[model samples]
Target: MAFLAQFRAAPNLLTMVRLFTIPFIVIEILDGNFGVAFALFILAGISDGFDGLLARWLDQKTTLGLYLDPIADKLLLSTLFLVLTHVGIIPRYVTVLVFSRDFGILLIATLLFATHTLRDFRPSLFGKLNTLVQIVALLTILGEKAFSSHQFTTLNATLVRSIAFLAPLSAAQYAWIVIQRLHSAEDPPRRSAPKTGLAQISAVEGADPSGSTDRVAS
Candidate 1:
């Protein structure tokens, strides 16, 4: 019962709700209802930001929250990228880059988990920046389509190109960091000398059995 109290916290509940909304947002976007889709997307984003703030302010942070937050962000953003690209609002190249980077990251993460090489690797700054660009691109695309604004369309196109270029660059940076960390972990520290207190005895034994007594006496 004591443990159950932790799960009932406000932030955790909000995070859970955000996860639940991902599929609904995807469905609405696919149905060609940009208005409701945009609304749900905004709601999801707000919930995401609010939950983090709530967790920090109310001291309701949890291990589950840490894991769920990133997963929810990835799932929601990835789905939007795919759906919007499929419908021609988002450029195909942008979606391709986003998906490729995400796929690469997931693959590396899986390999690390399987090999027990990584226990905890938080998102890098580059990765977070990529996500922010993606979110902005998605919102701009949706906005342009919904409101029919030329200015927004131009901005959307610019964001799409920027995201396409940055996605792979940021992904490669993350991969390099992971590889360096993995190598550091795998290569254990080298000792300058055998750390045994019986080194003299072993040396004497190697030299001559009779020398053991002399070495001990000395």
Candidate 2:
């Protein structure tokens, strides 16, 4: 009951709605109904934004949401990338790069969690930008197909190239951050020097009822 209760939040329900749209979007894409797919994709994007906004506005953020939100985003985006690649809409290399980075990060995160090395899995700025680039690229492709325009060709190419660049760059940045955090976690704490007799006397005099003066003892 408690677990299901977490999904009762409006933000989480919105996320669920987004997840439900994925299959329909996939079906539309597979059937080459680009216009319908584009509309569903747009709806998914809107729901993604509103879920976050509702979470903050309503104070309905939950731990389940923290995990569910990103998972939903990744599943929808990754699946679309694969499906689009199959249809030759998105280049295979772009999907490969995206998948490689995501898979590598997932492996690293799992290993770190199992070993209890570091648990902070916050996405870096570059990672966020990479996701944004991917979203725009997909939108461009779908819009081009739905509207039957040649103008999108140049912009779509640019967005694809941007994804190629940002994917690896973001992965490298994430690795560097993880390495720094691991080093920080492993580094020993610096010990303070022992207080001199006079300093000890002063500390004792200033001690609180809880005997926090011990903190100054070294």
Best by TM-score: 2
* Model 2, span 70-144: residue lDDT tens: 999999999999999999888999999999999999999999999988888989999999999899999989999
Give all TM-scores, in the order shown.
Answer: 0.80, 0.88
Off by over 4 Å in 2: 195-218
Cand. 2 Cα-lDDT: 0.92
What's the true lDDT of residue 194 in model 1?
57
Cα displacement (angstroms), candidate 2, residue 203, comes to: 7.9
Candidate 1 residue pairs in clash (backbone atoms < 3 Å) = none
Please give the distance, in angstroms, between residue 177's alpha carbon in candidate 2 and its true position after superposition. 0.5
lDDT score at residue 133, model 2, on the 0-100 scale: 89
Model 1 error, position 216 (Å): 40
Per-candidate count of clashing residue pairs (backbone under 3 Å): 0, 0
Score residue 145 of candidate 1 by CA lDDT.
63
lDDT of each: 0.81, 0.92
